[model samples]
Target: MVDQLRPNPAYIEAVLADAALSPYRTWMGLGITELECDRALVVLDIEDHHLQLRGTVAGGVMASLIDTATFWSAFVRAPADAGVANVDLRVNYLEAVPKGARRLIAEGRCLRPGRRLSYAEAYVRDERGHVVAHGMSSVLTLAGKGLAIDLPKYLEENE
Candidate 1:
C-alpha cells in the first residue's frame, strides 16, 4: 500500500480554490465547501450550469461530481501533491437527477493507494435523495514540483 500523506493548510486551501476555478466547464465556478478523508465525506455545492436541458442536473454533471469526489478521496490517501493527474477514470450512471435535485453531495473513499497508482470510488446523489451516479478512478503522479506545503500565495492566490 502506498503511504498516505497529510496536506498542508495552504495546499488544502488551494485545492478548494481550484474546485472553484476547475477548468471543466461543467464544474467551473462550482465549489466544494466541506471535505474530509478520515471519514470519507465529500460535499459540494452546485451552480446553475450543472442543470441539464430540462433543468434537471445533467448526467455529465453527475459524472463530474463523482470524479471530483473520488479524486479527493485518493488525494487524501496519496502524497500531498496538488497536481496529481488522472491516469484513467470510468463511470456508471444509474439514474437521472430530477430538476433542482437540490444540493449535490458525493460520498467517496479510497480503495487503495499503491506506489504507482491510487484507486477510489464515489457515488453521486441528488438532493432528491436518489443515487445519481457512481464512479471509480486511478491517478498517476507526473513530473512536477508537486504541492508539499501551503501552496505559495503565488499559485493558489493567483489563477
Candidate 2:
C-alpha cells in the first residue's frame, strides 16, 4: 500500500476540470475518479473526432496526461507551501489506441520524494486489460512557495 500522504481529491478534481488542460488530454476531457498522496488513477474518455487522422490519441495528449497523472501523486502530498514541477518525463507506448476506445486509464504512484525531487511511475491502459503504455517521471520540488496560496475551500488540508 502507498503511504498515507496524498492530495485531496477535491483539489485534484478541480485541476482536472480546468479547461486550460483540455487540449492536453486523450479525451480532451481530463478527469480523475481516484486520488491520494502516493497514488492516483485518472481516466480519459476521448471522442472519435478528437483523435488524429491516424485514429490514435495524439502523442502530445498522451504525454500530457502521463505527466499530469504522475505529478499529482507527488504534488498532492506536498506541503501546502510546496512548489513542485516536473523536471523530466519519459513514456513508452506498447500499443496503439483503438479508434473506438471508451477511455484510457493512467495509474500512477510516487516511488519516493525528498527535499529536491520526487520519483514517480504509471501505467496507461484501456478497459480491455491491455498494457498500452508506461512511464517514469521526475518532479522537482521548488522552494517553499510551491502550492497555490489561495486554495479553494473544497481542498482540505492534508492531514
lDDT of 2 by residue, 1-159 (tens): 113353455555554454235444534576766677778787787766557888888766677668877887776666655657888999998888887888888888989976678899988888797878889899887767544444535434432
lDDT (Cα, 0-100) at 103 in candidate 2 = 83
Pick the lDDT winner: 2
> In candidate 1, which residue ranges exceed 4 Å CA deviation?
1-29, 38-48, 143-145, 148-159
What total of clashing residue pairs does each candidate reach? 1, 7
Point out the worst 10-residue segment of candidate 1 by lDDT.
Answer: 1-10
lDDT values, one for every candidate: 0.62, 0.71
Give me the runs in candidate 2 sitting further than 4 Å from their true place. 1-27, 149-159
| Candidate 1 structure quality by residue, lDDT tens digits, 41-127 | 555566677666667677777666677776667665444443555667788888776655557678877777655677888887767
Please give each candidate's TM-score.
0.70, 0.76
